[model samples]
Target: MRTSRFAVTVTAVLALSALLSPFGTGSAQAAASTVSPTGTNNWSCKANAAHPNPVVMVHGTYGDMTVWNTMGPALVNAGYCVYALNYGSQATASMVTSAGELKTFVDKVLASTGATKVSIVGHSQGGTMPRYYLKNLGGAAKVNDMISISAANHGTTNTGVTAKMVGYPTCVACSQLMSGSSFLASLNATDETPGTVSYTNIVTSYDKVVTPYTSGYLSGPSTTNIKLQDDCPADTASHTQMPSDPAVIRLVGNALATNGPAQATYKAKCTW
Candidate 1:
């Protein structure tokens, strides 16, 4: 039963991997600003009183900063300074190494924007990896909010089945994301949500990649776990589509609109 389940999980990851582009690819080239999404990587942007903290967007495996094209502009228009980085060779590298990269990128964002703390918005692995930075690398002191959309917070059971998938061999982070991996064991050791940062994990019932999407949820003080269907029953956004999904974006906006996590009872404005 366990082997069969693993096989199913691997199949799901392979199938969805093809759909995650514009989200990113294996290369780390800086996306062209002309073709790139709005409201990202703008170094000149400064955080204002209305939105005191600049937002740092982290992309998932096989993804880049371009993943935030939709949500990025929304936040920007809402008066936020948004930034993103291409890390882990499009986030396929070891998550530990990627966390270091995140730390360095965040430092640059802080210095440039002169903001004391930054809020983070991530998708898939993008969502889960920041916890490492926060817990192991001292990111808790610098982050105010963490809103993860379909993140593999507890590691997904999907990719550990095999490496026969096209790019699976190169995805060092994949093994780390397997259920019960040492990385996750240590990551979730004592506190899944640590420090003063508010955590909001947004999951989709239809997500196949995370294999039982509840794995994305974090438990601790100031943490909220939301299901897309809970707020909008008709919405069926999948794992990869989350970064671009309208309802998910609304949830993200709601989370950022407050000082802490998104209110559990807030109703999202559903759209097709």
Candidate 2:
């Protein structure tokens, strides 16, 4: 699981890597790579038959919809009707709230697009928190595929301390992120991937956030966990950068391109 940190933690690696990242440098380059589509952000945009499900971008803690500034446009350019949703204030609210809000937003998306199901691509809390909707809130009936980037699937203590020592949960969702919170225990009581939904989780080895990032791995049928470095050994992106990483984006783009057979896993050609 990736760190669900709301505040940006500037590490020396993150700073230096940003200067050399192949994904692009600053906001100017980011804008250039994420080309806008004539149909982007239009709720009425036609959904391509190849990518039938409308894609929804979910942001992490303390993050708003703008977090998808880079990826959102990319999905749009790929002929997907993409929408980004912001949940929780500073993202401190409970997963219950997150689930409800997502359901409402998905309902709106389906109504607007006349599609039955939508695909999801989430980061950090946005990645892990949605399980509640799928497992308990009837989202399994709504979502087709879920792709998580640096998500905290099994829970994480990114603060470098146990949840108990941190004086318990800082908020409702925070409790679930604790290593042994009741919320987590209940969440894992059954299959991690439950339903007809296909899932892919992406993680980076250099993440200082989601301690022991392997905690992000998902187990069950139709679920795949991707280690970004495995595909590109030279990749140096930090946890916060996963959503915008080129390698990560390539995998997402391929997965959504399900021509005749949907490939659950796709490897990127190492370019770093």
Candidate 3:
């Protein structure tokens, strides 16, 4: 049963990828912008009093604050106070253990923004890692909304290749760590979307890194998990591009709109 389910999930992800292939890819130049700090090393701006909560952008593994350079300015121009950070540094490994570091960053954001809570937008691991802070580090009460872009909430099997090359134990350990293990299960038990905070998961069918993209889903009444092609019929953005895709951005903007529906539709060609 487990193997069949895993296969079906993988097939779904591949189908989504094929659906997104024609959208074209994103460029670093296209998404690049100059980032200025509001105060000290903290990147901040005055929150529109009407929208009191600041928005913090968290990048995935092997990424820095620059990932959101373009997106941040767009949010700021739209009247949101935006911030970004680099976390989960490992001397031996690349990008891992990011969730464990989120609590510290959340505290820093709170201190810099002077807001009781903030909205978080993360890509890849950045998306699901905050759930750790939300559930374990008192983040549930401090976060107003969480927007995860192609986050690996359930874990990926592609890690098996690295495990084979590096050693069985290393790859197995990494996959187990990302996937919902006992620790993650414990966190989920707290409440899928706890407190007054709203949760939004935005995923692309074409994500190659986070295999079996359904792993990105969050099951909760207050949580929304959206597949991008559903919102824009012509959108075919891959995993890496989802963060910068114009269609995805529009969906995110609409999701952030106060008057928008808690539930929205996303359509895509599917194969199993």
Candidate 4:
């Protein structure tokens, strides 16, 4: 059973990597040369009254800052200062250490933009890892909004595969994402939503990586959990594709525009 699960896990990881390679690497490299498609790592951007908080984009497992090539440009066009960073060696490092790295990057963003607080937009592991920064590393005070795309906020059911794989030294972060892992337990022990930060989780029904997609939902005040199908029934975006999904970006923008979480009444457009 263990070997079978490991094989499945490896296949899934490989498939996802292949699926993302074209967009994650090819388009990222091309976008790196252009200014309109990608606007990340702009240190000179300043916050304006219309969009007081600068936006920070975070990527998921096996991902780099380039993962935001689509969403980063969208936010920048919407009149927000956007920034992204590569952390945890493509997010395979210890989550605790990644959270600390996040804190450092956010501090730099705040200082560079002269903004008191910023909004966070993250995908997959990127979404859940920032909670550690908020809860433990004094990030809550520095953040106003957190928009998560397909995050495993409560962990995933693939523990059978990742649990055994963590025996190796290379993937310590993988085990922490398994359901009921020590790291998740500690993260959700007291308050799933800490500080004054508003939490918005935008999840898709077709996410194979984070099985039982509802696991992305958080239980706390100022938290809004949204299922893509609830608003856009025809949407069938997978876990890895959620970041680039147009409907997901719309919802993320809506959440950032509001004072609290996304409005329960907001309906998403069914766009591929």
Query: Which structure among the candidates has the greatest lDDT?
Result: 1
Q: TM-scores across all candidates?
A: 0.86, 0.79, 0.71, 0.84
Residue-level lDDT for 128 in candidate 1: 89
Better of 1 and 3 by TM-score: 1
Q: Write the per-residue lDDT of candidate 1 for residues 1-272, one digit (tens) a residue.
A: 32233233233333222223432222333432333456467889887888889999988876777667667766676668888787887677899999999999999999999999999999988898999999999999999999999888887777542243454456678788888899999999988898999999999999888877999899999988999999989888888788877678778888888768999988776662
Query: In lDDT terms, how accurate is model 4?
Result: 0.77
Please report, as a residue range, the 10-residue window in candidate 3 with the lowest summed lDDT: 18-27
Q: What is the C-alpha local distance difference test score of candidate 2? A: 0.67
Model 1 stretches with alpha carbons more than 4 Å out: 1-35, 160-168
* Per-residue alpha-carbon lDDT of candidate 4 for residues 1-272, written as tens digits (9 for 90 to 100): 32232233233333222223121121222222122225566889998888999999888876667667667766776678988887786676899999999999999999999999999998988899999999999999999998899888888886432432221336567778878899999999979999999999999999887877998999888999999989878888888778767678778878888889998887755552
Ranking by lDDT: 1, 4, 2, 3
Which candidate leads the pack in TM-score? 1
Candidate 3 vs 4: which has more TM-score: 4
| Alpha-carbon RMSD, each predicted model | 9.3, 8.9, 10.7, 9.9
Off by over 4 Å in 4: 1-37, 159-169
Q: Ranking by TM-score, best first? A: 1, 4, 2, 3
